[model samples]
Target: MTNELPVISLFAGAGGLDCAVERCAEPPLVHDGSGSPLRVRVATDYDGTALQTLARNFPHTKTILEDIRTVSTSDLLKVAGLSKGEPTLVVGGPPCTPFSKSGFWIEEKRNSQDPNASLLDEYVRVVSEAQPEAFVLENVQGLTYRTHQEQLRRLITGLRESGYSVEYKVLLAAEYGVPQLRRRVFVVGRRDGKPFHFPPITHSGESERDREYDPSKLPFVGVKEVFDGLPATPENGEIADGTFGELAAEVPPGQNYLWHTDRYGGRPVFKWRSRYWTFLLRLDPDRPSTTVQAQPGPWVGPFHWENVPNADGEMRARRLRVPELKRIMTFPDEFEFIGDRREVQRQIGNAVPVELGKVVIRALMEQMGYLDPLGDGARPEQVQETLLF
Candidate 1:
């Protein structure tokens, strides 16, 4: 029998989570002395642009460029060379916009004829049909909000009825070594009655409210820790060429346009506290970054705080370059993104943080007895040393 467990990925945008699962069975990150890494037999995604990016990075995997609704469990299993009872793991992050509080409310969207609302159902259908030994579903934390409790209940019930014991938690990416404060909900299910335990937090922030201070944990990585080494922007850094550019110049690091004053050259065109929190937001060098939005508007941000010397030697602000954003998302530098500027940003922003994914999958591996529980797995140093870029 093969030592490596096969994996089937769905809605695998840019394969950030897949990359993490793949690494669990590979070098420095590998916990068990397994002969080969986890085999990603098949991956499916509906977005052509995202599929292109996934195929580019994982050329060896059989990437199905089709909607998950149209693909059958038998087809996925056949492609993966697995039988009904074979050991396998299915992982995916369904489209979150339907349930994202940042977007539309789930209840309101459910009342409307939103096509994406049924995506969670489709994900459940695949798991039911495949009946894998275990499955992991990732989604926006809004799924667990009190207002969406009914939806959450139905989801858990549906998975349980499919013969799996499930547990879920909202995980902060920064606590898991990612340099961004992105919290995502992960639902893990095992058909064999085994309960899934989350991995312990490996990092903490200075703020008491951020997390309980633990001397054993590493301090949260700051924006400067990652961005300082990159190339500097031009003196008149490339601004967004509109009102955004005008407002961005006035906002300082760690603050948004809302903090702009009507003094000096700064013009306060926007009403104070009227704009969304993301507008003209700049990263703070000392703190972890805010969540990276899937589509950053001409004015909205998670923008960089990089300053360039203007003609008068004055410092000026500029929006972050795509590469800098990718780093914030925890993608390896060498990982290629194959799309136009907007499409690439969407793929990167929509991805699971690579470090977060590694932590989750490593926990699953240990739970399944595939790896030694006591093994020194998924250390930040090991991840950093093994990063291709």
Candidate 2:
């Protein structure tokens, strides 16, 4: 172990994983880990906004905003001021849409090489070539589906064949402190025989460990807890222009779209019907959120507070906003995205939650002997900046 835990980031969406790793074990609280401060020396991604965000947040690091398939192992470490055999960490996830639980059903040949689905192989290629001491792969829970289960099985087997000890599991974001109920599949591998451990869930409301733990136990962060401090003003300010015509004209507070129309005396009005009524009805706020889809169409939307009904006397189902989405993904408020609204949403929705990554990384670091359990003093400084394009 050295003074800096060098890192190589792949498919680094909006640098959420990088930011989270940087903020893993900072001041005030100390972490019991085995690795040095995780340093993201090299971050590579195809998306311009994502790469720019990574660069903006980690100016000292080398960012390659190009197709990762063409990126060679030497090129990655060379830019990071390192060489082969140096202890380094590689982390990233291939686009998990095909394996996502909410993705379109692929009833055909699962082996078909869709450009997006085959990207997982590229990740494995980099791991083999770079030969990092350890690596982390994150993805949507869909990777565990029965249809695409073989792909995941192959990925784990491939890592082990490459001479690494690998571990993986599906994790709930709320269990790690994020307000949103997002779940993801995480995989870790170490070239050395030492086994890697996943972080334990520390914040379940019903988990007996909540009361059994000491006062220093981590607190459960909820939706209200995350958004409580934000301003009450709407981002669009009630759609004042009424661009959506009558639908927008009488749009109730917190309501985004209407599925039905009503006409009064010489006036046409619109009505809102909750989409996916059954799913919305079962949203147990006391527990974690259901999976957040890439496109939160009418049927599945983020629910408002239970008792806090909107102006129409109906609880409006609105998609989670960008900042809220980022928070839900466990990205620090300081980290920014560099892209259009749609791209931003896609990145956040498609990303690995930061807090969850931190816990995983912390566990690995501890195994490598990098963290100080007892507060030893100065830790890395986390900067506050908008990294999104």
Candidate 3:
């Protein structure tokens, strides 16, 4: 059973979490005493584009491109080659739009009865029916807001009644090695009544620094660190030649268009602080990026603080390329995304950072007594090429 623990991945967008699981099963993360690595028995998603990306990256795994609501546990088990009572692991991050802070504030759609909001129930249904040895559920932190606390309680209670011990926490992705400040909630459940320990933070910032300063806490990764080596490009591949591009040039690093002034030919079209922070937001180069949106507007930001020398030797601003965005999201350089530009942005933005996934799953493995103490000493670079085609 060294590398055969069956895994069923639901809503597997671009297979980010799946990639992390695969990495953990094989390398430095999983050494001599670790239990068998998880094998992707089946991966399911309703989005055709996402499934295409998953297939491109994980050609060996069986993928189901169908709505979860229409799929039965028996069918999933059949595909996974697992018996009804066999040990298995189910993992998913259902679309969080329904319970997202942005979605919750959208007056008309705030009702919990909205179809999208009910997908959590679908996730629970699948876990109850599958009766897996363990399961991992991930979602946006807004789900734990006081308004949605009842839903959270019901979810935990339902899982407990179903015979799995459940524990949860809101985890910061930056702490887990992702180069952004993304907070997500994770719920882990096990059939054997074992409690899951959340992984300790491996990276910290000024806030954490005020507490006990541990020598092991690495400094937070900055935007500059990730982008320093790549060649510079403008809004559409070269220097920005449009009005919006010109405005971006005037905005300084770390500041948004709000800093623009009439003296510099800039106009205040929008009221101050009225727009979302992403509007004209530029990266600081010294700090981790703000959250990457799944769908950024034509002028929305967390835009790169990229600049290239002009004829006079002055630097000018430009938008981030698709590849740069992927790097910021912590996706492997070799991971191939399949879709039009907009769709690709959505897929990447919606994905769980692979680094964060590795930390969380490693914690789960340890808590379940599946970890071996011996070191494999194999790094990610050594194994990534073999895992992705």
The lDDT of each candidate is: 0.76, 0.63, 0.74
Return the lDDT, model 1, position 262. 52
Where is model 2 more than 4 Å wrong at Cα?
27-36, 108-115, 205-220, 237-288, 306-319, 374-389
* Model 1 local distance difference test score: 0.76
Per-residue CA lDDT of candidate 1, range 1-389, in tens? 33557889999988988877776643332223332246678899988888888888888778888888889889888987887757378899998886775655445664433567577888888888888889989998878877667667878988999999999999988887788888899999999887899988888885314546678888888878877677764423355554455567667788887676454235667676777888888888888888888887777777767655445665556667777777777776777998776777789889998778877887787666565556544233233333332
TM-score of each candidate? 0.86, 0.75, 0.85
Clashing pairs in 1: none
* Reference-based lDDT, residue 300, model 1: 75
**Candidate 3 lDDT by residue in tens digits, 176-230:** 6677878889999999887887877888763222444456788777778877666
Candidate 1 runs further than 4 Å off: 25-36, 105-107, 110-113, 206-216, 232-238, 261-269, 309-316, 376-389
Look at candidate 1 and tell me the lDDT of residue 180: 88
lDDT of 2 at 241: 25
- Residue 298 Cα positional deviation in candidate 2, in Å, after optimal superposition: 5.4
